[model samples]
Target: MLTLTEKPRRSPKNEQLNSCASSFADYEDCIVGFMDDLQLVHCGHDKKCLGCGEELAHLTLRGVLRGSVGVIGESRLAMTEKVVLLGGRVCAVKRFRQVSSGRREFGKKIEHLARVSQKCEYLVPVAAYLYAKRIKQHGHTALDWNQRLTIIVQIARGIGFIHEQYPPYEKKMQMNVHGNIKVCNVMVNTDFSACLSGYGFTQLAEPVEVLNTGQLMKSPCRQQENTTYSDELSQKSDIYNFGVILLDILAGPKGLEMTKGVKEKKASMKLEGGLEFFEFYVKEGKERRQVSKVLEIALACISTKPDARPSIEEICFNIVEIL
Candidate 1:
């Protein structure tokens, strides 16, 4: 199992060590101390490692990760995020919000995901799980076109594997659904591949009754029920969320906001205006046509009727073909 070394001794002349520090400050101090103890230098402000100017950003933990002893990075999620030292390697930790019950079940699910991640390159590699009262936030931004496409395809393959129940071994597990599929939940590894997060959190939400036809039924009393049901945690709902991610990729941050407005307007007008939105952003030529094709796929995925959407396998196939 992964273990941490003892904390590095502080310098006798450095008087700043006596001041009170926040948990995040303490974590940073620990990292700086460890680096100093090992006689390492900073590659830049974000990373430090042994040897002159060697990049340590790509490092991954080698063994089973232990919880909460030697944390190096921290970020907020549904609850909190942390990076910990394990066997001289670094790994990320995600801590969920505390609830009244089902802590055991939550841990089991995370353990299962960690095992699954070892076998699939697409899912985020989880090393350890932890429970805590509070933690700090970390920021991650989206990638460019080529990088985004690569990650999107990888995510599609990961979701496809879950839906197919195809584990690495011969034994088949139950078909799984990635109820959350959004840009925020997609993490970029050191190599720039996509790793999906927040898989099991969907279970924490209230369950919706599904129709026998595998479609989400609307509640009788609410007028906005259709919109609400369309956004529920389900296989089809995942596809819709993925479609939004696609739009985010095709359109940059600013363009995505415009497309969202177009989408809402299209919903109100009850028109299948289709790929015309691409014309505003994409040049009218081969590039536009290619984008239009991708937009078509995205449109189908986000169809108002869940039954109208393609299966995860089909979506993967289409994305692969596009790539």
Candidate 2:
């Protein structure tokens, strides 16, 4: 229920946000090296970039999937892979759409977002260049493939980073709202570290197009235009989106039924009784109740009253306290 009169921005220089201890200090040097090392080769623009026109030798921590299957709003989001420096300590990458026409403008935003990403762990940085690769669908894993503990901790830390913002960047930009957030957008590294990805649903200077799935996919954060809530694109909205993701993680694949059951009431329960569901199905024990609390938080975030929603700072504090 706690709220803020104004949004709290992330501090760029905070040690937690800028864990990247690389010797490269100047932003330009870091970007230049990252791009050069990528050595991108352009394959033709196909849903799946099968033929690598000029394939790079190795995959950097992040790059674009030639034709990734992503959906946004009513449109299937089309994205190009981009690798970004994270906290200066880790490398995080995801598919993104460039926002500007000219390289200069594009460079500026990428630099800005990179610094912002460094400052605020919640928002991802824009990449200097994009590398596209073919994507092959992987079969579903065994049911025994439970969540990795390290990945869970990484997600907690990543969300924690978003909650705590650093200094100068904090003073300049308002709290960033990740307009569209979902499980598909979040990535877990081989080491089980998680990073927030996909900022295309946010402020973009160019035309917005969803990745073409050729079929409609539900977008959790779509808002009607010219509404009383013109500020629907605020940071609180991102919080709501993040809540959905948290539910996805906590509920796992079967968790979708919980949501559906809530809606339909007639839907079959994952367990025979509510008590059994709470006792056995929910893994985190006491934390399972917290999912509903988090759901309530998401509800507040998406409330018609913009003023009613808690700021990122408040949400962070509450979540940390609860955890």
Write the residue-wise lDDT of candidate 1 on 155-256 in tens digits: 788777666654432212133777656665666655666667656444533333433220111111111122222346577888887776666566533334
- TM-score versus the correct structure, for each prediction: 0.55, 0.48
Summed backbone clashes in each candidate are: 3, 19
lDDT of each: 0.47, 0.37
Question: In candidate 2, what are the lDDT values of residues 1-323, reduced to their tens digit?
Answer: 00001112236576332321121122222245453434332222221222222233443323222112222322223332122223221222232333333544444444454545555443343431212211101112311123332333344455556445443233223334454455555555433345565443344333355433322323322221111222245555655555444434444434433654443442233222332222124344554544445544544554456577677666655555545
Residue 217 in model 1: shift from native, Å? 34
Query: In model 2, which regions exceed 4 Å deviation?
Result: 1-77, 82-101, 119-175, 199-201, 205-231, 252-280, 283-305
Candidate 2 — worst ten consecutive residues by lDDT sum?
A: 130-139
